[model samples]
Target: MDDESWALSPNARKPLPELIEDKIRALITNGTFRAGDRLPTEPELAQKMAVARSSLRTALQRLQLQGVVEVMRGRGWYVRSTDVAERDEPLRFDRRVSDSDLLEVRIALETTAASLAALRASQGELDDIAKLAKLHQAASVNDKDELLRTDEDFHAAVVRASHNELLDQLYRSLVPQLRSYRRNSYSSAEVHVRSANDHNQVSWFLRRRDEAGARAAMTTHLLGLYNDLAAQTGMPVEERAGLTNYALEDEPSWQQNR
Candidate 1:
């Protein structure tokens, strides 16, 4: 298909990148693009969509994050999968799993990853995690995109530092859903600052090779998120009680604040 056939409307209610993402998915659904099909070059896509190359790149990145498409180094973007709808099935918020349920799984995966990272992460990985932590901590509340990106990067770096390929892969698989969860969860500047501080605490423990401290820090970080989500979702008292029963030496600061 030619680039002309992919032109998007000039007037769009949604963000340009989001509209472009939907259009691409529609094309894929209609069989215009399939697995292994190379998408047009960025310039071509930009021209056809009447958007800047940056916007086109943003849409493509979001698709890549969702596992619908992937970019090959020095090549072009290609359709990675056509089963986009099914890809997010298991973690679909409120449908397949509650938001709290997702965080519960994250708590399990990330706390252990943090502990392993403290023991196994090399100096270079530890430095990267520290750098990302600082960046996320310094992100401006006014810039939600940067804040979100930095937050995701910090966590991913921590997971990567685990040096466990399977653990990293599992965390990567949850990126899209977690990204969605984060978008809805960042309700205030206070929340952002608290999260950034949590990242710093995680990095601090990892740098010192404090396995127990790293695990506890990660637990505190995610438990704050879990509590917030539970409150907002009106999670059942019994369910909330079950999920919040983690053993710790001291009360989490967030809980103390409340």
Candidate 2:
């Protein structure tokens, strides 16, 4: 297909750069652009998409950061090879990612992801997130395996909806530790109820595009989990906070809620 075929009508609700990125991602995913295929020049892409050159460049830069494409100094961008883009080697975890550390990082990273997802996620992505959350909530307390998988899917979907490939990559690399933490935290029916409430709040904020609300919901959810683990394991608040660089505000609402 010719570059002109890529022309995109401007969206009043979405940024031009985002629209450009979505189109390019669709092209790559659909096999219209194979690995190692050189993309049209920046000017050509901009003209073809009917977007400003700056917007086109921004979209390309974002894709490059995600390892979706490689930019050759003067040559142009090329689709990244599958072997390189989706390597077989597993990401190595720091030998020391304790439960505390995992929760700490989850609070920091997931809250930000939720915030961005509120701003960037499409309706379809939001639907997927809500569906997973509902599935997790509806699973029988005895059905541990299904509950765990559904919970993971809900969180993973939120990260993907953030539209930041680097964040998605980082979260995925921590899956092993995350799974362990979820297993430890989901022991009580009360905890499950609390989690369902938190996830519902998260989905609500995301649907409304309320960034702060989404961030707060995610933070509250993870902090609640952390507090639960700390209580169950008899770990000190200070020690847990030290693992992920969080401060213990004595009697914080998140901790007090339980």
Candidate 3:
């Protein structure tokens, strides 16, 4: 226990490292500290969060262990970018800005490709998707990371089984972006649970080779991420195109806003 550990809401039941980890995790998960952004120095963070310097160090070390941040020699610790843990570590952000633009195009392609996949997926592909969805539905707090990775793998698997070499190539090439989106999408347990249910429904329909079912399931599920936001804020779906508004209300981070 440390001086400020007693001040956190989760209580001292969680260790200092875990408390610090929670804070850092909240920042990344809430989009407060995005990729490529530098983390505050140890002392600065310790002061800002009212945590003991030693406790903060422990937290940073734990984050490093999780491959969520790094300590550069002679420099300072920085939040690890990218959705994936270590395997996706080396993916630098120096790539062209077209990557973000291409993401919109990829989303359209992927959404349709998943629909086509519902029509043509093999027994094995269908089985895997169903299995992953089930696991996600049954997942608990302790299994969040596992469920998240399995969910991504299942989606990527669908893209791969679509039988279009060009589509597969394009999708595989976009894994980095996909990973980032996945991370950004699941900042709350409510969202994760909703997505898991939708995935399970999609998987069930795809298994039946119902093209309409699969397409509708996928489109509805994916669009829900933004549609829910728009609806919550009373914004028309079409009007959302040119707006920068997130339109999400009572988000988890808002509770932390000073």
Question: Weakest 10 consecutive residues, lDDT, candidate 1?
Answer: 249-258
Task: Give model 3's clash tally.
Answer: 0
TM-score winner: 1
Query: Each model's TM-score?
Result: 0.65, 0.61, 0.49
List, residue by residue over 9-85, the lDDT tens digit for candidate 3.
57658887677777677677667677667787878788877878877876675455345675543367777654433
Query: Mind giving the per-residue lDDT tens digits that candidate 1 earns over 1-258?
Result: 776678775655789988888888888989999999999899978877788887887788677656678655457889988987755333334456556656777888899899999999999889878888888888888777778877876787788779886776577667666677787677799999999999999999999999988988998898888888778878665657333324754322222221
Best by lDDT: 1
Worst 10 residues of 2 by lDDT: 249-258
Residue 88 of model 1, lDDT score: 38
| Ranking of all candidate structures by their TM-score, best first | 1, 2, 3
Order candidates by lDDT, high to low. 1, 2, 3
